[model samples]
Target: MARLIDLSIDSDQVIQHLKHEVKLKTVYQSILCKQIIEKASQERGITVEPEEVQAEADQFRYDHKLESASQTLEWLEDNLLTPDDWEAGIYDQLLKKKLADSLFGKQIEAYFAQSKVQYEQAVLYRILVPYSALAQEIFYQVEEEEISFFEAAHLYNIDEYRRLACGFEGKVSRWQLKPDVAAYVFGAHPREVIGPIQSGHDFELLMVEEFIPAELTNDVRQQISSQLFDEWLESELNHLVYSQ
Candidate 1:
C-alpha cells in the first residue's frame, strides 16, 4: 500500500482520516456485507454476467451524464478509482442483487401477505406542540369544532414546512413512523381525530384524513424483496461467532 494519497497531505491528517473511515459503522457494515455476499454467491452459484455488467455500466454512465469514455475516465480519477476497481465494484453490486433474488425471491409474496398492514399508508394532518397541555388544548378545540386541525397547526405547530402545508404529512406507511406514533395512527379510523400522544420531546395531535390499503404492485413486491433480503443479511451477520 504505497500511501493511497501523495505527500502533499500531512501524515497526521492522513492517519486521522484512515482512523475515522475504518471506525465508521457504514464502513464496517459494507465490509461484512461484501463477505456475506461473496459466500452466498459461491454457495448459490450466482454470477455476474458480462452483459449485466455492461448494462449496469451503461446505466451508470447515463445517470452521471458521462457523454464519452474520457469523461468516464475523468470521473474515475476524481473518485480515486481505477477502471478495474470500477468494474469490480459494479460486479460486486450485481452479484449481491443476484444472490439476494436467488435466495429470497420466492419468500417475497408470503412475507408481503403476512406483513401487508405495515405497508398500508395514511394521509394525515398533525398539530405538534412543545407542551402536553398545548397539544391537549388543540385537540379539544378541534374536537369541539372551535378550530380546525389545519388552522391550529398553522397557528401553533413549530415545524414551518408542515405549518405551511396545513399539517399535511402526505401519506406515510406504518413502518415509516416511530412505533408509538404508528400504533395510534394506523389503529385510528379515517377522518377520526386522535392523539395528544407523546412523540420525542413534543406532543402531537393527529388526524387520519384517509387510509390507503397496501397492494402488491410490482414496485412494492421489489421493495418487499429487498427488505426481506436485508433482514436475512442482518441475522446472518449476527450469528457469525468469530474467534482469534
Candidate 2:
C-alpha cells in the first residue's frame, strides 16, 4: 500500500511536522468526506449531467465577472486549475449538494420554524474601546442623547468601518455573534442602548437599532436546509466505523 506522503525525513522532523501542520488534518478530513460522498452517491444512483456541470462552470465565470474566454483561461491558470479540473470539481460539488437535498430537503421547513429564534437578525451600532471607562462614557453619552451612537462610534470605535459608519455592524444573526454578546443583544429591545461588555481585548457598547424576527422566507428555508444537511453529514462522518 502507498502511504500518503514521503516518510524519508528524520523522526523528529516528522513529529514536528505532524504537530505544527494544521492543514494536513483538514486535507485528511476532506479526503475521508469525499470517499464517503462518492460511495453514498453511487449507492443512491446519483449522477451529474454534463449540461449541469457546464452550466455551473458558466455560472462560476459569471460570478467572478470573467467576461471573456481569455479572462476565464487566465483565472484558471492563476488558480493552477485546468478547465477539466475545474469542471470536475464543480461536478463533485453539485453531486454532493444533490445527494444532500435528496436526503434532507424535506426536513428544512420544520427545522427552520423550530430554530427560528437563532436566525433572528438585528441591525446594530457599536463602540469598541480598549478601556472599560471609555466604553462606559461613550455608552452614557449615547444613552442620554448627548451624542448619537453613530457619532460616538465615529469618534472612538477601533474598528475601521465602525469608525466610518458610526459603528454599524449591519444586520447579523445570533450565531454570528459571540455567545455572551449574542445573549445580551438578542434579548435587548430595539433602540435600547446596552453595553460596556467585555469582548476579547475590548469593551463594547451595543445598541440594537432594529430587530428582525425570523421568518421562513424561501432563502431562509434553503439556508436552514443546507445547514441541517451539513450537520447530518458531519454526524454521519463521525459515526463511520472501520473494520481491521
Candidate 3:
C-alpha cells in the first residue's frame, strides 16, 4: 500500500478559517430568515394573499404616512430590497413571534408568578435646566421655596415641552431612571425633592411624586414573564449547540 503524505494545511489555520466561516454564515442565515419565511408562507398555500399583505402594508403606510405601496416599494428598492423582500421580512418576524409563543408560553406564565416584584410603576417629576446662571438661579429659588417647581421650570428649563408640562417625568419605575437617579429617587422619602445633580451636560432635579411598590398587573407581568423566558431559552439553546 502507498504511504499517505500529510500535506494538508496547518490544523490551527484550518480551525481559524472554519470559525470565521461559521461567523460569516451566521450573518448570511440572519438575512436568509426572510427567505425561510417566504418559503414557509408559500408552503402553507398563502398565495393571492394581497389582503393580508395590504393590511400589513397599510399599517406601515399609516404609521409612516406613505402615499402608496408602490411608493413604499420604491423606497425599499432604493435601499436594495424588492416588495417581496419586504413581505418576506414581515412574514419572518411573525413566524419568529409565533415560535417564541409556542416554545415558551407556559414558561412565561410561570415567570410572571416568580417575578412579580419587577413590574411596579412609580410617579416621577424631572427638570433638566441648562447648567448656567439661569439654572443655578432656578435651583436656589426652588430650594428656598421662593418659586414653585412648576413656575421655575416653566421659566428656566431648557427643554421647551417639559417646561410647558412643568417637568413631569410622570410615572416611571426605578429601572427607567438612570442608576444614580434611580438610587436617589427610590431610596429617598416619598414626595422629597432631590437633585441639582448632573445628568450628561444638564442639571436634573427629580422628585418622587408618588411611589407604587411592585404589583402584578397582568400586562406588566406578561411582559416580564416573556423577557425572562426569552433569556432562559436563549441560554439553553446556546448550551445545546455550543457548549463543550
TM-score of each: 0.79, 0.87, 0.61
Ranking by TM-score: 2, 1, 3
Best by TM-score: 2
Query: Which is better, 1 or 3, measured by TM-score?
Result: 1
Pick the winner on lDDT between candidates 1 and 3: 1
lDDT of each: 0.85, 0.83, 0.66
Tell me the lDDT of candidate 1: 0.85
- Compared with the true structure, model 2 gives a TM-score of 0.87
What candidate 2 gets wrong by more than 4 Å, as runs, is: 1-20, 241-244
Better of 2 and 3 by TM-score: 2
Residue pairs with clashing backbones, model 1: none
For candidate 1, what is the TM-score?
0.79
> Each prediction's Cα RMSD?
3.5, 4.8, 11.0
Q: Give the candidates in order of lDDT, highest first.
A: 1, 2, 3
Per-residue error (Å), model 1, residue 233:
1.7
